[model samples]
Target: MHEMSLCENILQTLQQQANAQQYSKVKTIWLEIGELAGVEADALRFSFDSVMQDSIADQARLEIIDIAGQAYCSHCAKNVPIQQRYDACPECGHFPLQIVAGDQMRIKQLEVE
Candidate 1:
């Protein structure tokens, strides 16, 4: 699954941050995952443990913050919640929606020592 690769990238980022910030260990990671990012949280959690083995972030706690998908509906001129890409606007049933948020995955905070 792509979550494995995503976890690997996360490890790489953590390693880089550790070096740059001079932190020896990571205790926790707060991750913001948007619903529209297409990432499975369970898969990511499994992959993270596997990928972080023997690394600085080994056994680190992963705190996931789920972000709701949102889009701007031109027909209704309001921002509405969405579950998937190309979803019809909930308010006006418009086909084309301008995505406003919930399409990103990022590290929000890290507890390190």
Candidate 2:
């Protein structure tokens, strides 16, 4: 799955951060993954160790925080929680709600040496 490549990207980012921040080792990493970000947490976890092997983050603990999807419903004139991309607004049955959040994945925190 693409989760392998995603892990690679995370490793690359960790390397870049280690260089910039002068950290020699990474003990933990906390990631914020939005529901709509299309990342499978289990798959990413499976790939993390191999991707981080021999890197500064080797054996690092990975923590994923799940973020709920949210969107603004023009018809309802309010924000609502969404599970899928095309979900209708919960209150007004509005189609195609404007996404307000939960479509991104990012590193939230790091514990480094």
Candidate 3:
């Protein structure tokens, strides 16, 4: 899956940060993965272990925070939570809502020494 590549990219970024900051080792990585980000957490975690083998991030602990999908309905003028995309507005049953949240895959924090 694409999670492997994503993990590789994250490791690369972390390596750069560590080298720049002169950190000895990474301890933990806190991540926020939105529901609409289309990333599978378990798959990503597995990929992380696979890709980090023998690397600087091999012992890094991964903490994932899952965020619910949200959308702003133009017709209803309110924010609504959704389980999936293509779900209509909860207030007014409309399609093509402007998504307000839950479309991000970002690193929130890092624990390093």
Question: What are the lDDT scores of the predictions, listed in order?
Answer: 0.94, 0.93, 0.88
Per-candidate Cα RMSD to the true structure, in Å, reads 0.8, 0.9, 1.2
For candidate 3, list the clashing residue pairs, or say none: none
Clashing pairs in 1: none
Q: Return the number of clashes found in candidate 2.
A: 0
List TM-score per model, in order. Answer: 0.96, 0.95, 0.92
Q: Which is the winner by TM-score between candidate 2 and candidate 3?
A: 2
- Global lDDT for candidate 2? 0.93
Candidate 3 lDDT, 1-113, residue by residue in tens = 79998898899999998889989687899999999998999999989887887888887899999989999998988899987877899878999888888888888999988
lDDT of 1 by residue, 11-77 (tens): 9999999899999999999999999999999999989998988999989999999999999998898
Q: What RMSD does model 2 have?
A: 0.9
Q: After superposition, how far is residue 60 of candidate 2 from its true place, in Å?
A: 0.4
How many pairs in model 3 have backbone atoms within 3 A of each other, for residues 3 or more apart or on separate chains, i.e. clashes? Answer: 0
For model 3 the local lDDT of residue 78 reads: 86
Per-residue C-alpha lDDT of model 2 across residues 31-105, encoded as one tens digit per residue: 999998899999999999988888999999999999999999998888999988789998889898999888988
